[model samples]
Target: MTLQQWCFSYRGRLSRRDFWIWQGVWLVAMVMLFTLAGNNWLDTQMAAFCVVCLLWPASAVMVKRLHDRNKKGWWALLVILAWMLLAGNWTMFNGTWQWALGRFVPTLIFVMMLLDLGVFTGTAGENRFGSEARPVNYFGKPNYQ
Candidate 1:
């Protein structure tokens, strides 16, 4: 799939193959950014920005991951809102314990969500979210067939 198509196809299922491919792309991009940016402070900041840009695809992959488990993409909205609240609190308080709490708690929640995604398998056959991601063989039957 094209990167844009893969990123936007949140309504359907994702195969493990697709998920790993996107993750590899994310990791390679991040490594290249860090290696090329070097030690310059300005370059480091620019690389941070580039990392955020690269995270779009990663986030999209995560969304599809959630979808594979039959969860709604709206779950990502909660994650984003929690992050925004934490960031806002941190900015207002300037790194106090309260700020740390604001940031840390949401991060914990987000991490838990990711852990849940990792362990949960999608429903077999067609779920409300989409078709089974397991591939069909050349005989035009499911591999399990």
Candidate 2:
């Protein structure tokens, strides 16, 4: 598949390299966006629009990467939720409950999710989420079957 397809599709497996590359790209884009915000090149509305545009592609890539590990893409949703609660300090429970569980539990879940996605290797070949994606060449040709 093309780089665009791999980066955007939610129905395929992605190699670790491709996953990291897209993540790096996302990081750089975020930094650039923040820089734009700093310089007033992107106003609040523009920043919000840009963030919305990035959300799906980021989620798509995360889902594909989860597929690579032979897990359902829905796990990506859990990851996001866990992250939001953990890092964003969002809690529906009372402050006491938050005080008890918030400090350690959410952080643990968040780190485990990161290790699951960022450290684990993909299934050797394929199990369910279609066959492994063959690496494409510079010319956009598949390098292998």
Candidate 3:
């Protein structure tokens, strides 16, 4: 699939390897943004802009990744919701109700989702999402067989 379709549409399956690579791309982009913008309102604004622009792509990727596991794409929404709810508040819990409401619960959910998306292998062969994503060998070349 094209990069636009792979990262910005939710119409197909994505293998774990592809999903992992996509995450890596975003990680590098985030590091670059942070390093370039540094500690300032510009940094925050830039981050927000990046997130807004990438949100659809991020959702599309997660949906496709979930499809590779034979699950509904809407599950991606739950993950996004969890992040939206918990990603604020830099201060780690300090004996406030926010500890339970923000830190603890979201951490548990995040760990679970991480395992679900990043650890487990996708279902083999065709599924409801689509035909299996074309498999790539160790060198990232397509395996013809």
**Once superposed on the true structure, which residue ranges of model 3 sit more than 4 Å away at CA?**
39-44, 87-97, 135-145
55: Cα error in model 1, Å: 4.3
Q: Quote the positional error of residue 24 for candidate 3 in Å.
A: 0.5
Candidate 1 off by > 4 Å = 1-4, 40-49, 89-100, 134-145
Off by over 4 Å in 2: 86-96, 99-106, 136-145
Tell me the lDDT of model 2 at 130.
Answer: 82
Residue range 24-114, candidate 2, lDDT tens digits = 8888988988899889988967877887898888888788888889999888777566656666553777888786465666677767877
**Tens digits of per-residue lDDT for model 1 on 44-97?**
888989888766666776777677777777676767767776666454455666
- TM-score ranking, best first: 2, 3, 1
Best of the two (1, 2) by lDDT: 2
Candidate 2 overall Cα lDDT vs. reference? 0.76
Residues 1-145 of candidate 3 have per-residue lDDT tens digits of 6666787778888888888888898888878777766866456787779867877777787888889889998777777666766876746656676677677777777788778988998888899878987532335445455
Alpha-carbon TM-score of each model against the true structure = 0.64, 0.80, 0.78
Q: Which candidate wins on TM-score?
A: 2
Between 1 and 3, whose lDDT is larger? 3
